[model samples]
Target: MSKKCSFLYGTLAVVLGIATSGSMVGSVYATDYSGSETIDLSADITDGIIIKSGANITLNLNGHTISTTESEDTIYVENGATLTISGDGEITNIAGKANIFNNGTVTINGGKITHAGSYYAILNHGEMIIEDATVTSTSEGNSMVVNGYYNYTSTDERIGYVEGKGIANPTMTINGGTFTGDIKNCIYKGDDGSINNISGGTFSGAAACVLQNVNEMTISGGDFTNNNSGYPVINNQYYDDEIDKGVVTIEGGNFTSADENSPLFENGDNSTIEISGGSYSLEPDEEFIVDGIGFNQQDNNRWEIDAPEEPETLPTVTEEQNPATADDILTTAGILATLMLGLLAIIGALGFNKRRA
Candidate 1:
């Protein structure tokens, strides 16, 4: 073929490729990964992502932003979808809608979620795990992570902060993250039958690091601080419930409050606070402390679980109950037998000497 014909053929192929590119725009558009593909955001998105069902997508922000000016979720996750957000990027919402409204499962492995809105940075009505991320709520009433409503009678009533939208099970696990907010909670759960697990995080709220209301919360580990003068680091409020089964079990954490008058933990209203383990800048109130558990207050004014004392044990001597073993008994018998034989020989020799004389 001639050079001109070859160039014309190449241009045709490029045009055909653009015409056949369905939803996979690669970088220009925020689309699905029907083949479980990773989409790197080459530019900031004004219109947010509404993930389709059964689509598992990994969106790498790549130091870009996924911001929306409209009053809609920045990332609307539908049911049966799994969205893994990674890279050092930003997800912000200028409107009143949530930055991330999850109805399926959303795992934030890394990113920054900041919002200047009336809603939460994350409004979850499904399973959400924040492994390592930063979520900041600047407004006084805005929160970092809030869960939608859940059906208490249904078995789907699981972990999350409830009070928004849903027919889905709300479960939020904060494994590792940096959450900060103003008057509202950095993390909160108020829904009936709500259960939240915060194993690791750095949470700081002007009001409370964790504002738990009438439910279960297992804070295995974290660093919590509250700047509010009236509220504690963990403010738990339990109103009257028919089941009477809501409990806040704080297994471990580092609690601190800038307000010296405020306690690290506050058993507000009718809440039951079971603190088996934690390190508090100040002492925990007697009502909140677990029974039979001791806290060691260090010189630095921090209080933690007292070191477990080792039980005094006697030294073991034999396989069974004995000071003298079988070997000791046998040796004693042999020595006695030898002495008797020697005595008998001496008597025999004396008798022989007398007879000889």
Candidate 2:
């Protein structure tokens, strides 16, 4: 062959080899899970994972990482499907819509999810259970949003209410994890019929640590802190309508506010908050008072109210009113000490009498 032809042929051969290798690498990294199956990540993936099948799917991270810059979600769970994450791994969304956009059930046992830009770390329109995980959002938006959809239409006669038309109401349960969203709410529930339960976690935010418009939330244990001045650590947006009422029960948690004047909780018009136990602290200010729409201190560690100025028909049960007397405790301790000393004296006398005999 001529010199020029030989050079062209060599270049073509090299191009073909590169193309073949690229295809092989793509095939090795790409993963599309469907049906009821479990997949373990063997290597770091660039392309996002999509779940189209309406079946239960399990993705084991296996200490790998999935990083993507695509506009789509890093992990998308379609409606009528379920996705469970197991093992330790990290999901990095550079500019995606969401790190995990769950329209179905998504359970995270162990993982690290980080999202940047305007999207949420987890936009849940279905059910989400974070047993153990770390979720962080650098965006100004919320870190986790449990949303419900409703449409209202007015007719000549009356207004019609349609439920479950757009996005289904979500139910989120956080047993143990760490959620950090410094700009907006760490967790937000937008509509009614949604349930949020946080048994254990650390939720920090610049605004409200948790905001619920019209929903029910039960917080047993967690550290909720609001770093900026906007709403309280837990805010229930006020609504005068009876149907738009929200309910919150703080069984146990540490709630703090950066601003001294800010209330640890802001109960809405018809909303109610029942605080059983939690450590709460605010900046020392004698003028500052704990006030809300319906605020009542039922006990030293409990507060309950339905709305402002509502009559307290129920009996007031306060720790101070019916407390254990210090004298009672001291008397019991003294009795126990006297019984022990009497026994010791009897034993000494028996030994002395036996030696003399």
Candidate 3:
């Protein structure tokens, strides 16, 4: 063989070897890591990992399990960066801290994410998404506490047990997967203003799904169960700005608020709560006013609950049957008399009715 041909064949063999060597192994890559890093996993990892900042990283796991023993956060993302986890992987943490915290964007396309966090299981500052994954949270068994400190003073609020200091009004959207947690406040959009939208998923939060001030909470389509103890599913209150009233809207979803109050509560008139679709049933004592829109559900599993643009009208049907009037009675008597006279004329012709009255 020629020397050039031999060299090409050797290069091809090297490439193929890397691809097939660790095909069934779990791995981690820190493509955007600029700071120092350390990784201690519960399972064996096949390939070495890198840490960089401002770069895209893909952490692939080959059916391996990674658990966090201590209270420290498992996955931490700083600066402006992106972290994507792929493959049949599982991340489990047994504390109140989240397995992943992204100051930028964190996407979990496929994996099993489990947490027993004392606080929030996963906190995102910028944007966070879970697609085609199973996220489960066990009982942290912590008491519900809601106290924020100001000038070394603490006041008790029924704040979310999971989320302590509310999030910075970040835009949080979930499209797919199962998320279960025993959280006081699953997502808190601090006083900075936030937008929360859930299109598709099976989300079950032990406490309120959202606790924020001056934020917009919108649920379109999903299997959501907010079985909290004290507050409603979406509760927003006590803000510095009068413009911080909360807006809770349920456009479409399979949602159930088991408590006596509503699954959603808008305290002042400034706070607006609208429900448009999915199965809705409040407690007997609680009433849902129709000041907003009606429930409209589609077969395709997509729904939206929003304020109507125009007013609605009642349906008109045909009138029902009633008793006969006075005019009908007079007309019937006259007809009977006419028939008698015709019969009498025929009898007179035959010499039968000769007496005249």
Candidate 4:
């Protein structure tokens, strides 16, 4: 081969090697976090972050992004582990499952978590706390769901008994954050012992802002909005016979709805709502009443409702005694004139009798 030809071939080989190395450098695999560790991502990650058992991990996005293209959670926290996310980063999951499947505790202090075409932004079976963050679900699913599982054991006649255990209930607490979604329910609590507490944040949904099933919910300070029609801003539905009642207490917050027919509170089966202090405003056609129920005005800033009751009616006036007719006025004046004439006659008769004596 000529020298020029050899130089050209060497140049092509060098370009190919560089391209291959660059591709290798850009590709990132799934990371398994064990023990106590902190990982700060400097580039976009393509795989998920897994926290193994007995691990306490903190994954800081560091202004980067973690994305997953598969139908899986972007971050999976296993049992007996904890994951804390900090920094103003992003976690994008273009999957069908939840973006965060938390079996253990998961705390998000600052970040943006988005789930597109997913069931939920966060399916928490353990505990989740969002202090300052934004979580969104961009599909027909909920933005956040706190659910539970059941455990059972099956025994075979020929073999030993097999035991299976799973999550039972979950809890979520939001101190300051934003949860928005265009779905059936933005925030849902599906199992017993599932509790949701919102001290400060903004929650909006397309159909229903929140739906709790036989659970307890407390909201101190927040803003809740529902955009759809014929649905309440907060709906507490009964689960089953075993757990027939759900309780919701609103100490302080702001509740509004875009639908005219939607009330501020909806109580299903055996649910109760106690509003201690909140600014609840609805559309012109909307009201602060419950559907097919009654509420008690506990105080100036509080309202409690437990069961259905008849509304109180105002006392009826007797039409102000027919507004004093003309006949009545004339009769009263005649009686007064008669009394004056009798008094004058009695005085004249007494003077004449004294003169005669």
Best candidate (score: lDDT): 1
lDDT (Cα, tens digit) per residue for candidate 3, span 1-357: 344323322332342232323221112233323342222232432211212245455566557765545454556654355567778877766645556655556677778866665655555555666676776665444322111211112232112212332334445676777766665555333333445666888766655553444556677778756676455555555343432446666666775565655545535544666665655444211234345444443354333343457868767543345456678889999999999999998988777434542
Off by over 4 Å in 1: 1-35, 148-168, 183-187, 208-210, 239-245, 309-357
What TM-score, over all chains together, does every model reach?
Answer: 0.74, 0.63, 0.56, 0.64
Ranking by TM-score: 1, 4, 2, 3
Instruction: Score candidate 3 by TM-score against the native.
Output: 0.56
Task: Point out the higher-scoring one by lDDT: 2 or 4.
Answer: 4
Q: Give me the displacement of residue 4 in model 2, in angstroms.
A: 40
Q: Write candidate 2's Cα lDDT for 1-357 as tens digits.
A: 444323322332343232332222212112232346566766666556555435576778888887655576777666667789989899888764777876678899998987777766676667889898887776775446545432223221111223331233467888998877655554555454556788888877655555555666788888777777656777675343433447777677777776666777766666767665556664212222234323344444333333346666988767688676779889989999999999999999999999999
> Between 2 and 4, whose TM-score is larger?
4
Candidate 3, residue 94: the lDDT equals 63
lDDT for model 1, on a 0 to 1 scale?
0.70
Candidate 1 on 210-283: residue-level lDDT in tens?
A: 55545667889989877777666775666446322357788998888776787676666667888889899887
Model 1 — TM-score against the truth?
0.74
Please say which candidate is ahead in TM-score: 1 or 3: 1
User: Alpha-carbon error at 273 in model 4, in Å?
Assistant: 1.5
lDDT of 4 by residue, 185-225 (tens): 64655455466777988877756655455577778888877
Residue 117 miss distance in model 1 (angstroms):
1.4
C-alpha lDDT (0 to 100) for residue 127 of candidate 4: 79
Q: Global lDDT of each model?
A: 0.70, 0.63, 0.51, 0.63
